[model samples]
Target: MIQDYLRQQVESKDYQPVFYDLKNAQDLHTFEALLKSRPYIRINDEIYSQLRELMKIRNPTKRLTAAEYDEKVQAYLDGVEIEKFGVWVYYPWNNQVVHLVNEADFIELRTSRNQHKITAAEIAVLSKKKIGIVGLSVGQSIALTLVMERLCGELRLADFDRLELTNMNRIRCGVHNLQVPKVVIAAREIAELDPFIKVKIYEDGMTEANMDDFFTAGGVLDIFIEECDGVDIKILSRIKAKELKIPVVMEMNDRGMIDIERFDLEPERPLMHGLIPEVDIPTLRGLTDAEKLPIFSPMLALDNASARMKFSLGEIGKTITTWPQLASSVVLGGALVADTCRRIALDQFKNSGRYYVDFEQLIV
Candidate 1:
């Protein structure tokens, strides 16, 4: 019955439902607070009874008087979706509710007291999106940030390595996840965090051998976040994405700051791809250390002023992975990623190219 109601809500929007799971206590409390503040979320008598009982059981001394409960229920009654009644109580283990609404209209319904400005309805739009993640150190932070924001429906996590203790300083995984594949650990966290969210992990990550299959096989990824460390891999991914017309995003965390790039704005956009395609493998092998440094060094469009200011790359690198900077940058990166994803999905972001974040001077 609950499924049926959910189906109706989804069908009315001409979208299909892929994931539906119950929320945990913390999420439920958060949801309840959201509902209470909306003033427009109606609860039928049956549902009200259940909610009241939950409140009473959870806080016996703070139980609402019958009069007060009735009054509150009455206020929300006018906003009830009569046809969609009673579906919110489907999962009992967790009073929290998470649903992938097929339609964008529902984005208006998701809200929390802490973030009342955002609605679950808006998050649903995010859920319909799929993003490719290409690295695991800062990639871990990127993944966590996206999932927490409820920004994308599915995440395509690509990493070639296993978790090591050395990575604990910056990665999302911990001692319990050591030795586990980065993709596996990230997937487990995603499922536990939101069962309805879909996660596709590429344990081998992306490579010349498998890149074609990964990109062309499943649905086309809406955008890509490239965190892979190898210069060749980054170069190849950028060129291929341009050819395939998929947008690829990359970021570098300089000391406590981040620099992001969006390559392949138009289908025929130019190639910023580094080493593989045009140059033969032998030529790549022949390059000396002096030649290779330029290939690996980031290309900047910095103004003469910015370029003139010389700073040590080693110090910049050290600062980004440090405490407050690392944490702030990760959060900032995720928020930016979320905003970018939203614009792309809604067709609101007209231009697509590169974006840089310099935390040191708060410059972008």
Candidate 2:
């Protein structure tokens, strides 16, 4: 288990990410060269807006002599550190350093290769695939995992709420990132990791207005991962996947085990297969809060609004916390989601629908 290795504090320097600080002019120049050789940052709409503004300032296209480039670098440094310029510099030919920056004039940059266990050929297949994620919490993990795997050519992330301190336990972000919408965060993280990826994030709540984003005349989504806690969201997603002849998969964290469901590829699936004949989009989308109340209330039985209110006033001293569930479940759920995606992307698995597990049982 990763916990064991983490607890042991095993030393493996090679696995550590190297950070090079731009301390001097020489370091700055070296870093610039490194950045120039580094890859471009890929982004969806929100991030594209930010990068577009920077691109206008540092157009890399025209002509800049070494002296001119240096002048621009110094000017940029006046506002931000040379290290904070946001560029990835690496050489494909000799593995040497080059310069890259968020404000560079270049319209595009080199593509980054996936560093996970999966291979380029595997990613090539994923790039041709499209998937939609529902519910921004677990969906956030699914997004990061897929991006890290470099799986999925185009990703569609849907969520309504912005990041909050409550999400820090399960979501991969810091307080600095609080208030950033999940859609924006997902897009930025992808671009920061590899600018070559294609990401489309829907910050607005998914509804009839934007259902087309998931499936347009351009292309039908290849797969759907339902993470929305709303039963309506699942109903809608399953319906759409079935109508489009796309497959749908969903994962839920039950204690420590993950509950996985695959619909459309199998004959008798639960929830997803329950709504439509092989699942229809509208039926899925039409699910209501009332219907979900029963399904979710049980999971939240430990929580009490009165107790929570009392705790807020220091009466109960804060008894309820998501940390236990978040730590044991969220990360594992993400890993399982990624592994399942890898299998699906590689054409290695067809198992589907309503699977669950608990990690404590395994440990015991």
Per-candidate clashes, comma-separated: 14, 35
Q: Candidate 1: what lDDT?
A: 0.56
Residue 230, candidate 1: C-alpha displacement in angstroms: 1.6
Q: Which candidate is the best by TM-score?
A: 1
Query: lDDT tens string, model 2, 282-363?
Result: 4544444444344444333323223332243242224533212254466677778877877875778877544445545555
Runs of candidate 1 exceeding 4 Å displacement? 1-121, 255-265, 273-278, 281-292, 298-328
lDDT of each: 0.56, 0.57
- The TM-scores, one per candidate, come to 0.60, 0.58
Q: How many clashes does the backbone of model 2 have?
A: 35
Please give the lDDT score at residue 235 for candidate 2. 58
